[model samples]
Target: MFFIICVVLLLCYFYMRPTVPRSPSCLVGKTAVVTGANSGIGYQTVLNLASRGCKIIMADVADMEKSKLDIIEFTNNPNIFAKHLDLSSLKSVRDFASEILKSEDKLDILINNAGIGTAKNNRTADGLHPVMQINYFGHFLLTHLLIGLLKKSPSGRILFTSSLVAFTNNLSLKTLNFDLEKPNYFDRHFVYGNSKLSMIMAADIFAKKLKGTGVTVNSVHPWLVKTPLFTKIHAIYKNVFFQMYIWLSQCVFGRDPWEGSQGLVHAAVSRKLKNATGKFFGDYAPWRKPLKAYNKQFCKEIWDASEIYVGLTPEERL
Candidate 1:
């Protein structure tokens, strides 16, 4: 009986996942930026906010013309625009942030949502782990640069799309330097875990840093979804057997992108959470604790090191 109940519960968890309710909260004059807006949950989140009449900026490494047109057509909300952001490159991140600061007076929402599932050992032009840069450090820099603008709004929001996989990470200041050095036995299963954890750690830190600014920093575990993220990872391998493994895993663990994005939209616009910050939200808004969510000293050490890694100037320090 216990075994049957466990199986039933798992099935229900997957199939009966809640959708983010339509938020009655008004966003008439707000402007939001979503990285990874080219596809997956990021795309869906953009659509959700656009429908609510928030001016949307679709930022991604890809050419956003087609996706932008599609969202505009569907939402009939013409305020959506596209911008380029290549997170793996520090220069690109700075350029993007600079452009935003010069053009937009203030940014109301910032979603650090671009991510990948690749496990290949590689370093970016910035001499950091490509995965870590794209998933965490790049956004860290962008957020610092844009902190001023976010503070302009009475209740600006900065949401990081962390994952349950973050719980699996075992990290330190030393291990975090995976740009040239690597974590022991690094592979696909563990490649993305640490990056996710770093994001949550960042949220913990920022939630404190922005305490009096009325700027909330929160993280959400958007749940597993077989989005093109896995499809892109599949292209990384040539062996038939490896491809099959990837496909089988997604088949068992993934949900639709729309469903996976529910937690994010809920975290983004839910009126109930207007003043909430430093919270780690799970699928559909259940509170999920972050890994070492309160390790302030460790997070600060990593933050200082990250500032050096990202080449932030003294004046840029927040």
Candidate 2:
């Protein structure tokens, strides 16, 4: 069919899209931390930074020993280390930050890259929505805690792995409730979108807060790579043929993970972006603006609400 032919052609084009070459700039003494660094975009981004001689902390819920060893062997970067960070729990996030602050003198890059495609409509023990907690609020707290350490570096950068799904997140303050209180709906897809949108909103707010502090804030969308989370979510419906079709489409059309990570790599390390802040990298040209960003009053309200939800004390407020 003509439609099928066109679909195949489109897949070929995405498959052929050019990859941003790895940066030649070195990060010899700089320290960077990436969550969800065991796999997907986080894994590839860590590899890219490791190749640049950066000391990397692979923070995730997974057992990070093997992943750290693999990167160490491949890049011959001895400074790569693994650290446990379970973003679903606020205590885990705080503990991770505490460990980092006590051990590392400074942090140059912090990529809030850990995220989930679906969270099964659950709530974290902190009484926050699971996807929102893992995708946005957990990073929210982590960044707030590590901000001083980031400021300790001569040039610091924070990057959030937002998603294109943000464009569809038509969220209001009530629906954005972290605790899933009464009158709040729990649509998994929309929550994911809302979380991504929240991330960009945080970047915009942080860019303003960190102004003139030598730290830059940005967010990136790692365009539809071959992640299995959403697929599993839909497969729960038990549709046999549709599941096969899903696998086929992803196999034939998904961007390779390494190529998908280039925009993040560029955002995290490229010298050209040293002064770039409060921006979105929708792709490798590495710049786009989300619709909800820059609305100062609205964003400020969201930030204030987030501070309360995450239980940040007066002293921890940025």
Candidate 3:
């Protein structure tokens, strides 16, 4: 009985936690790119930024015509544009970056918000694990390719959407790319957590390297929100008990997508955080003291390996 009561109290606390409020500052003429903008927190972030008069570029793998229409109609802003970007494919990422560089004069904000939670082991066309490629490597490369444009802005900001699991999971950087010869060794959840950890580490590394360059890099945990990612999990678990557990958790802890997007929005444009960089944010505030394992050495190792994995040329190194 006591355990049940404690669990109930915890659920209530999570449910009632306050979200970051939208910024009142105008972003007129500022340009931003948000990956995975078709749905979930990414979609909400686009709406919030568009409402504030920022010109938005929606980057996603699938067709975003519907989302673009909805955003234009809802925000009453026609500055939203769509671009094709398949994070799983290195070639696609390069092509998307090239087009953006040629077309847009400047990139004021970049939100690397696309991610996936896979239930099965799979490899992308780039010969890396699907989850790792989409969640970490692709964004790593895209950021590097666009650093020039980001630097052109007065105060550029880059935001990565990480997760709370990164703090608790035992991430093995050595096994980032699961060996195809040993397919049996792959664990879906572990790989997913490692990918998120990589994002945090990469953000820290970029922030350090970009010092005095007028560019800020940060990562954020959007909290638990009911999004399409759960549909994949539901398909993986068919047991009655597991299904019930998922339902209970969502009902108790999940916030609406807009509420979940607050931390990301705050990191992107909040005046309170304009000068903050190399930080992890949650609940619309800085998350201090991440695990000691996420050290400078580890971050450097991951950054170097990512450069090779993404085929970043020497000319592109920052």
Candidate 4:
């Protein structure tokens, strides 16, 4: 009887997991830019949007030729273009934005999807924690630089690929940087969670600042996804038991890249959420309530601190 009950529960869990719906709206003539487009959910998102007739810009440090080819062939949309964006490098972010500003007159969607989860402590060329730089600060700077172009559009949407970990961690606004001096400071999971939380907070602040500008900003926790990010975790833990656990968990609960990307696509193109801004989405729908840790004051502090970390000038502060 116990075994039968357990099996029944497992079946129900799998049956109830939300699936991404095909976007009903057409995106002909719309323009979208997705970071980390070379692989994972970003690559899947590019394919979906491209198929709907949206011109796409694939930005990542990885060689995007294969992804570009696949998207072009699968969607038969030749407008897919690639731009080199190394989210860990502030210089690279600026360079990519400059190029986009010069070439593209209109921007409809900006998906800040590139992220890293490193077990080791490392710093980027910008002198900040690598995971924090790639996950939050870099996208923060990129959005600031591209706001002018986004404003030119009739309606612009900004989507951040956040994680469930965001809700599980508390951010220390005083030290966005991990304390290398402390023995417990090198907790990579905590560091990564903090960065993700910051991204969600930043999205909320941006939504308020850009109110009535016809541009909206929101964040989504793409379900437990099977992507290269986990490969990094496996590389960190060489234990056979740990590796086996990862494999088992992925086999049981992980969503494919396409399934994981549904929430992001839904956030970007769904007519129902056209005016929804500063909201958290999960399973292609909004959370019933706001996160308890979401404080407007703390969000402002994060915004100011991030501006300084990224070297934004007073004039550039938005």
Candidate 5:
């Protein structure tokens, strides 16, 4: 009877402990830039970082005037500002980078969190698949353009928003280029998955390349959070499988945007993670990889392929 009572009390204590969420303190003088910050994961991440005293730069495709107001309202910090960025266009990325270079010389954090999932059969101004362009290549060029600024920070961190779909996507040399003649129409989830896989591979290669530069790169699975990106897909497609997925998301797997942003925040600010580089993380710790992420030949292939697809030669940073 005594032991049973003790176990019951322990269970009650464990259940009623009122777990405290992770809310780290002030960044003070540091600067953080989050892409797609108008809503969803990006917006929450911006606020979370701002709460810690980091000067926040919010970049997105939305109207800057309204977004600025919203961010100001959300953060109530004068340090928060919005920049117009359309990641679909490489030129837009270049122009945004140029503007940022003129304004801020150093960036402590670069969260490549802006992306599109499955969009219609369209191409960017750069003549690439809209999904691949916005999701991977755009972030690719943007990161390179800002590498100089990120490197200026004492312990710079670059975070990529990868997805579990990365494992589900089909990737091939042919698909990397939008080969219309290939007889395969886009599978929205698969394309998104491929882009995410590329992102993970890119993050790994990027961290390896920047080995001595004090810049750390990591990719994250933010889990299934409800965001506007899903609404863009066709209803018929959404009905087949995505609806059920979203339902499951609502029931069990989904997180609020704020909760989803925690892993990114932890990666950005935690001193404990200073040495944790060139890896994937989720749920706020070094991800338990089913297999080791490092494969010299595969990594090299991905780097080389990405470089080709983005029109970047090995010698060129942009």
Candidate 6:
């Protein structure tokens, strides 16, 4: 009887998984900046914000023309514009932030959704690890640089795109060197996980820093969605027997990009969660308890290390 009840409850939960609706209420008269907006989860998130009347700024490393075309296909709204941002490059992040500052006075929502998960063990133009720089440090720089603009809004929200891998993958700060030092393939998972862990820590630090400033900061684990972002991994892993494993895993855990982005949108606009700052959320609710390493001291250390690595002190950026 208990087993049957558990099965019924599980079935209901799957049957009632909440979908991201085109609600006109969440984003009326707002200005939102979304990174990696050209494709995957970022693309779906951009569409969601735009559908509710938010003026959208789509930033990505991809060509502006390509991003613009994608936006056109997704939404015919002219309020949307595309900009260039290579999150792996500190200079690129600075340049993109500068450009946005020149054009927009205030930013209501800044979604740091751009990320890379390839196993190439690469580095950016900057000498930092490619995944680390792109996933965490870049967003760190961008957010700090634009905190003033975000604070210009009545109540700004900074949403970071973190992942569940942070809890599962092992990391050590000694292996901080870039592509040349790390494994090119199998070990890429740890790098990805490290970057995401850094992201969550950064978000927590930002939230604490902006406590009374009305600029809330948070991070989310958008589910493992099957998007073009995973094409490389999927293609590489899709062999005769691996395909079945991938399929079964995805069936149980993966979701579409739109579904994955719900937590982000919820965190971005939900007034009921006004006190949700600094908290890590997944599937649109506060994570029960963050990993032990996600404590305040770690966040501060990561912040200091990041500032040192990026050569931008908090006062200097201000």
> For each candidate, what is the lDDT?
0.83, 0.84, 0.86, 0.86, 0.77, 0.78
Give the residue spans of candidate 2 off by over 4 A.
Answer: 11-16, 178-186, 234-249
Better of 2 and 4 by TM-score: 4
Check candidate 3 and list the clashing pairs.
none
lDDT of 2 at 51: 89
lDDT of 3 by residue, 192-237 (tens): 7788888888898899999999999999998878898866776775
Residue range 131-242, candidate 1, lDDT tens digits:
8889889999999999999999878999999888887876678657564444333454455787888888888888988898989989999877878987987797677987
lDDT comparison, 3 vs 6, better candidate: 3
Give the TM-scores of the predictions, in the order they appear: 0.90, 0.91, 0.93, 0.93, 0.86, 0.87
After superposition, which runs of candidate 1 have C-alpha atoms over 4 Å from their true positions? Answer: 1-16, 119-121, 179-185, 237-249
Off by over 4 Å in 3: 2-11, 14-16, 119-121, 180-186
Candidate 3 to truth, TM: 0.93
Clashing pairs in 4: none
Candidate 6 C-alpha lDDT tens digits along 222-276: 8778777666666655365655766655665678888888888888777777667
Model 2 TM-score, all chains together: 0.91
Over 4 Å off, model 6:
1-16, 19-26, 64-76, 176-186, 236-244
Task: Residues 80-150, candidate 5: write the lDDT tens digits.
Answer: 88898998888898889899999997999999998886665656678788888788888888888888998
The true-versus-predicted C-alpha distance at residue 150 of model 6, in Å, is 0.5
Root-mean-square deviation per candidate: 3.0, 2.8, 2.2, 2.3, 5.9, 3.7
lDDT of 2 by residue, 110-191 (tens): 9999988665556778888888889999999999999999999999999999988887876667767544433232365688
* Worst lDDT 10-window in candidate 2: 177-186
Q: Which runs in model 5 stand beyond 4 Å of their true positions?
A: 1-23, 180-186, 234-242, 288-293, 313-315
Q: Please give the distance, in angstroms, between residue 57's alpha carbon in candidate 6 and its true position after superposition.
A: 0.7
